[model samples]
Target: MSVESSAHTAAPRRVVIENCAIATVDARDTEYTSGHLVVAGNRIESLGSGPAPAGLEHVARRIDGTGHLVTPGLVNTHHHFYQWITRGLAQDRNLFDWLVTLYPLWAGIDDEMCYAAAQGSAAALLRSGCTTSTDHAYVFPKGGGDILGAEIRALAELGMRFQPTRGSMDLGESHGGLPPDTCVEDTDAALAATAEAIDRWHDPSFDSMLRVTAAPCSPFSVTRELLRGAAELARAKGVRLHTHGAETVEEEAFCREKFGMGPTDYLESVGWLGEDVWMAHCVHLNDSDITKFAATGTGVAHCPSSNARVAAGIARVPDLLAAGVPVGLGVDGAASNESGELGAELRNALLIARLRGGPAALTVRQSLRLGTMGGAKVLGREHEIGSLEPGKLADLAMWRLDGVSHAGLADPVAALVLGAAAPLTLLLVNGREVVEQGALSRVDEEEIARNVTRAVTRLHGG
Candidate 1:
């Protein structure tokens, strides 16, 4: 596969993907075994079974979709891109102890390391069929040299859609938080920087490539003042609010002892339990907590692999979906999950839900929905990018089912969820091909891997 930057030129005025199995994932869950999807500019013009639309016959490019399965591009709701360099450290530690072990090492991060890590992680995600991802980078070393900007730059260079959260941690170990003082920032400085980032990078328009969110690190690692201030700032800026909530039992206990309530209640008290807020993990919610999330339209990013790796209890996904909570998929951090692959995360979500409940816990279609439409809803972009509809963005993933892994499957869609992982044959963001033939189009994966290795070695004192 050739690697070339696709962002410089506009996509072909029209593109027609013909003779593929299309999973529309629309409101009615429409699907077709042999169909065509027509794209005019950045939006999908039309898609249906049978021959190509009348005027699309003369499109500049017509990709032959034989032996391919087409679906809406996957969306990742939560991630920590910097953690890509710390994947194997703190092998056996749980949430709190894991942070204790890695906080010191994270303090050594610089702008170069941030760029390398984001490139490596985003490249892996793009190869695995994730076109849009939200990276919650909460560690702001006092003089880390614009780590957030470096990450955004890398994402742009890789040609992936991003929502990079301006995450902060103002309470340190000196103030009963888990992170060290070196990694925490002054409250006012953090808020001001966050606002500056939104002003500089946020694009609220349709089919935007980059958006910014304001995120406080976590309940135990940040102060109440920072939480309230971030929520107010995000709302005023017209962006969303994101944070870590109900991820572990220790976090829930800390919320109870410090705030005289559970995690959900504390979130509500901080003015963060609303439609514009989406939380990560959420493995420890109770019945009332689920009710509050559903009623308030708050979203949840379910990191099944990370929760299982850290031994955090499984989230009640069945119950959450049953209660009308908008639930999406996330790989969390590479340090926690050891990989940032959304395809594998979708399979893990299905297997873990069945493990928690019975055989009828979750369906393959439901798991796919969580990775696509559910993630768009969680990030408040459902109107533009979730489904493969006439007016939606032409972001898509094409998987080749002719490989050995899916040779004998009767249903390609079910085989995608049940079979072993397969690399995406093609991926597009806003009608531009960022990944083609299972490789990144704009960046060299070998160079990214080498740079990330050097950064990790430097951080590890090698």
Candidate 2:
């Protein structure tokens, strides 16, 4: 069980993983047992379960994964990385009320809090076998913190792909938005800062690990002009756009009460319906709305735990997939979920889908696909990473099924989802091991924990 460090250590540029069950979540979620994956550089050079490839037998070093599950690294499509510091607050409230209650506390956040929370959230996600993930950090307190830059730095230091959006709030409580006046930004400043983030961090390359996005918070927090301006600016800067939409019934009621339309129509009016745009928590779209998203190439980030925790109805995820809408899984913000584990949410996705659409609705393959492939599509990084196919970035995880949770399991993929364990054995981002043998190999855990403690204490007025 001696895993060679990388690229054969010295002789060759390859990693040969043999005798494992590789679950390739391609167009079809296929499994091949007793297989081998030849990793050269940052791509899977070859993979199959038959006789070894011609050159594999001559590789420098090899480790056998006799009873392990080697799958594409999990992708988290949506999150508020900063909310790791704000966990366990304003619970039991609906979406709008919850935002109102937490806005003041979030306004108190500074750069240190943002960095600690970002690092902590990304670390937890990586621990949960996730490689590439997205962060929708939208609470930019005026004159308080460098939240976006800090998030980028945290992700860079941890060696994970980060889609840190420059989320802004131009409309406040005084102007009928969720945030307070102290937290909201002027329209000019918001747009300017978004452009600057794009210039500084937005990398559109195939192997990029850091990307910038423009997110104007949500419907109730941003004006119509800001939404259109965000889209225009993002397109001009060649980046993507993201925001919250149709998350709860309260949001629907607010749209009807305030704008006299549904959330889907609200998106259309604000020029936010198209490719390169994905909205989070679309739990309340109708048939026509679903068709609109399908036709327009819009993506949805389905948050099962957060929805059920807040008593929001389950998203029509099966229906959305059937209707051709690109839907992915998200753990949502920690303040709502309290735990940022994509594996747990994948289990919840299956359980909740079964509760709604009966058994055999959301299959185990579909759940993993949503987390791996569907998530890559949602975050607009499908070509770069997601599956264990060749030419994709070397982002993956190995779940050692010899543990207690997966005891007596025959099928490795099934054991992986049902096992309910986070922080996988080996996690890699761009061919770099961030979590090796169930511990973080990327950043400092004790330092991050100390920073998070200080941030949380400061948040509690200590």
Candidate models: Cα lDDT each: 0.90, 0.83
lDDT of 2 by residue, 12-55 (tens): 35667788888989776667977887776667778888645774
TM-score of 2: 0.96
Q: Candidate 1 versus the native: TM-score?
A: 0.97
Poorest lDDT segment (10 consecutive residues) of candidate 1: 1-10
Off by over 4 Å in 2: 4-12, 51-61
Provide TM-scores for the models: 0.97, 0.96
lDDT of 1 at 11: 45
Q: Give the deviation of candidate 1 from the true structure as CA RMSD.
A: 2.6
Judging by lDDT against the true structure, name the best candidate: 1
Q: Name the Cα RMSD for model 2.
A: 1.9
